[model samples]
Target: MGPNVHIWRHSRCRGAGWALTSPRARSQAVPGTPRHPLVLTETAAVSLLNCLFLPRVAEAASLPSALPLSASWKELVAMWLPAGKASGRLMKNSSTSPLAEKQGQTSMEASSQSVQATSGYPSTSTSTSTECKPQVLPVIIPILLSILFVACLVLNSTSLWIFWFHIKRWNSSLILQFNLVLMDTLLIPIVPLMVTYFSLGNSWLFGQFLCQLKIFILSTHLYGSIYFLTLISIHRYLAVAHYSTRTLWKKKSFLKKLSLFVWFVLCIQGLPLFFVLKTSVLNGTVKCLSIHQSEFSSVYLYYSIFLVTISFLLPFGISLICYALLGAIIMKMSSTSLRGRVMKTKSLQLIMVSLAIFIICFVPLHVSRTVGVIVKYYNMSCKLLLQVEIAYYASWVFTLVNCCLNPLIYNFSSEKFNESFSKSLRKFRFFK
Candidate 1:
């Protein structure tokens, strides 16, 4: 018999109310007992017994299952002895220990917290965030740009050639029309680049310098077109409203100086685009004119707003006022001589054509651009930002339609344009 058997039997006897001697007395009489005939010292026996049963006691206590009788005996003995202090608690009476239950509850709470964290909010990481991309107008934009580029190149080139070679008398309206055609011709070269950009999903393959140049040139074209249109409107207004006054509208030198002044103002206004417009890599792709919200965003925002006001809104207002006054004067002249009425009728037709071109080509673009600037600098929600991006690009492409449409407007509205175009086409054998 060993000390483990003695400990077991001693626990059984204690449960049965048997009186046990002290460990010292038990060691002195252990060799004389019937069950334990071995002569082991008290300290050595306790050491051996602890080495044998302490690990089992700890394993049984840490688990959620109920302890066996032998483990429970070891645990109760360990509770009264100081040597078993290092061993952890045991599940003696219940099926599960308090520590084990608490651990399980904590694990469940952690799992639920992880789930809530994932499902509660939108991800703010750049990799997972939603970004606004340009809308793909599959057939409309590419086709329109293609046709417009060809027509604008041919018509504007022909107009410039005729203005230089054939049309010698440069009236105020003729000079303004020449400037308009010049602006349109300058803008026509950018259309192929734009077509490639949009066709490639708005990815700009050109270098950063070209990107900045493209934006600068486009901005100049937009305001230049508007300024010339406004000048044309004012000329028509003067021709109708103040027919007797001999002002600068009849002087070739004054008209030339005015054109130069308009160009200077537009160039000054567009100087910021050369500095502010830039290309950056977004989502592993190069994007042009992509202004992000930054410390300078407000500065760019206010500048952009001012540009739109001066270039687009102001010209639009001036054109409207001029046309309105011209219309009233023409109406009053309806009861005058038949020749005067016929001339007023032709003027009204031309005014209507100019207004239609302005509204159709520029209005949607400026409105969408204004909204986009607001949404961009202010950091609006993703959905509205996406919508504004689509509208802005679509209207941008629509505005380019004006480059080609202006020649048509001039052909129909001006008798000189018609005569010049006809003579040029016949000279080039386009019409026999």
Candidate 2:
């Protein structure tokens, strides 16, 4: 081939003509044979450009059909050619060699990009993952949990030591409070694990079995504490309000049997957790008890409802009634004597603290969790579901406060335990 023919063939192959030519130059580059082949008429160039770009643009932008020749050519000029010296440089480069190949490579790259976009490959997956998985739990959640973990560890440990060592005599009230202490103690170790999970942004490093076990222990502590508090309130109410039942309330045997029954019931209630509580991985992070609201099952909804009613609602009612009656009875009791006034004050303290636990801790958790389940089960809007989920998790974090507060129940339940605690505290310089 001759020099002009070689240059023309090279420029055509590299798509350099699209950038270099202009409407005013149409007469110079006319359709002709290869011997004089520095020629592509406007119609031929338009058809060639459409063939090169239409499929890619259509797929990328979801266009219905090819744009008109004038519109497409104008857009193509706008895309590849810059103004002033840049256009001159592009023309010079096309007339030469290497830059034309670069232009062709850039076109190939753009086509590849459109193909990638059409196939849904790049930004879509990342955006979806970010939208689906929560960014970070509320800052206060881990903070409060860490505080509770420390408080629960200290208070429950002290209470456990006092009950086991300092208090020589064990009455039914002390026994019941000791069981509450046991529940708190059992739950204390789990709190730090929970804090770690939240601190790591809701990742559960523990395996599936441990996840189920963690939830199981939490559930057990929750309902177990509720039942124990209810039993304490009932026993106190019967002892104070109904004099004949004082003998029954004082008997450790009856309380032990009742405690055993509570444990059995709690065990039965926890069985479902082994099935429902699972460790799931979301966007490569392992999660436990962090199930998305939309993924909840109908069966889980029903189970949650049943669990809340029996474990929370019933005991809550019974405890409320018991405390109300006990309060009334204590109020009516003669406070003329120092002993009577002190006894009344202690009883009042127990009533207030237990009520605080029920209201501040249990009620919000049960209400939020139940509402979350219902909203999820019915396939509600994600907005409402997310609000409920936030409420539920917030309540869950606050409910752990009960472990730290149960020691107050122990303190207020019996005068002997209080005396023993004071003696133990006095032995240390902190209480001095």
Candidate 3:
């Protein structure tokens, strides 16, 4: 508008889309600067150049009068943003930025003030846990998991002792339930330390081989828990449902053969993890882990989940149905006394506890962990440690709950467990 404010758009070179901020840089102008990219008069383009991308080395480094933001954005525009074919970045920025330019000066000042506000005021609220203490977590979470894990193991061990020595001298039928307890006693010790490693943000201070071994053992034990519970359900169903039928021990060697088979498969099942799971460093923190590393890993976590349902959950559900069916059969066959009713009711109650534990301690963990694995394998950027921490921390509690709950499962399922446990107490009482 003013005579001295010359809005003259000049050419840097005829074909070049150079938008120089400095008047001296464009002092040697070509015939006519292509003005469409800037969408601005020379004066407005100069104003934007003055306002934003200049100050930092504008004096020292002479750039093209106009350059695109990146080689990629330029390529993208050329390939797609049709306007770039006719004009260039300066024109596009100038045309789009008039209202923005007016507000930008105000907003940029406000932004700088906000940053300074944080520096000056300092947060007065002590209740806010804004401070990050990743280092402290490794040292602390282990101690807590260790205490809880030990408590769980102690319960499982007591359950095992009752099953092993105190329970009535039945055949291997009762021992099926006890195996759950035995596995928990054997399996749970590795967890507190692993939880500590996980709490430390997945960094494995443990060596490479230990990392693989830990993952293999953890996976094996977790799956073993699932298998044993399923076995107990089937064992109990067979006993009560087919009371008139042949005993499990008397026919087909089902007791010994089946026990050997389940463990044999579980041992083989763990072998894949031995090769795949490893210590990984991400964002400078080490994590002992696996997220479908191979085609195998993807196949394993998901397909196995489906397989777990088909082989374990669905079968267990069938066992529950059979238990209910058998209870009805018992009610019809003999309504003689309260003792008969009490025994059948107790058997049903035991199976209910078994089902409850799986739903309570396992289902949530599987759902959350599967979601995490999907996001991770797809390489989405949102793997924030805080999110990872929350997800994994919740998962461990459930998963470890699963690891430790088997003893109660055994006690609930077997009647021999009650008589034998009482006898053991009597023997110990006499010794004292």
The best candidate by TM-score is 2
What would the per-residue lDDT of candidate 2 be over residues 181-256, giving only the tens digit for each residue? Answer: 8888888777878888988988888788888888899999999999999999988887777665547778999988
Q: lDDT of model 1 at residue 419?
A: 84
Specify the poorest-scoring 10-residue window by lDDT in model 2: 1-10
Write the residue-wise lDDT of candidate 3 on 114-171 in tens digits: 3235234444444532332232234454655676687787777667777655654656
Model 1 residue runs over 4 Å out of place are 1-139, 291-296, 335-338, 412-414, 426-432
Off by over 4 Å in 2: 1-135, 244-246, 291-296, 430-432
Could you tell me which residue pairs clash in candidate 1?
none
**Each candidate: RMSD:** 19.2, 14.9, 12.7
lDDT tens string, model 1, 1-432? 333334444544233211123445345564556633233443434443443455445455442222233344456454535433433333445477777777655654543443235335343445535556544446566666777788778878888887788776655678888889889887977888888887887788989888888988898899899999898888878876777899878677899999999999978887887787678777677878753324356767788788778778888899999989988887777556887866776777777778877888888887887787788776677678777766777787678778767776566446687788888778779645
Counting clashing residue pairs in each candidate, in order, gives 0, 0, 17
* Clash-forming residue pairs, model 2: none
Error of 1 at 137 (Å): 5.4
Question: Lowest summed lDDT over 10 consecutive residues: which window, candidate 3?
Answer: 1-10
Q: How close is candidate 1 to the true structure, as a TM-score?
A: 0.67
- Output the better candidate (1/2) by lDDT: 2
Candidate 3's TM-score reads 0.61
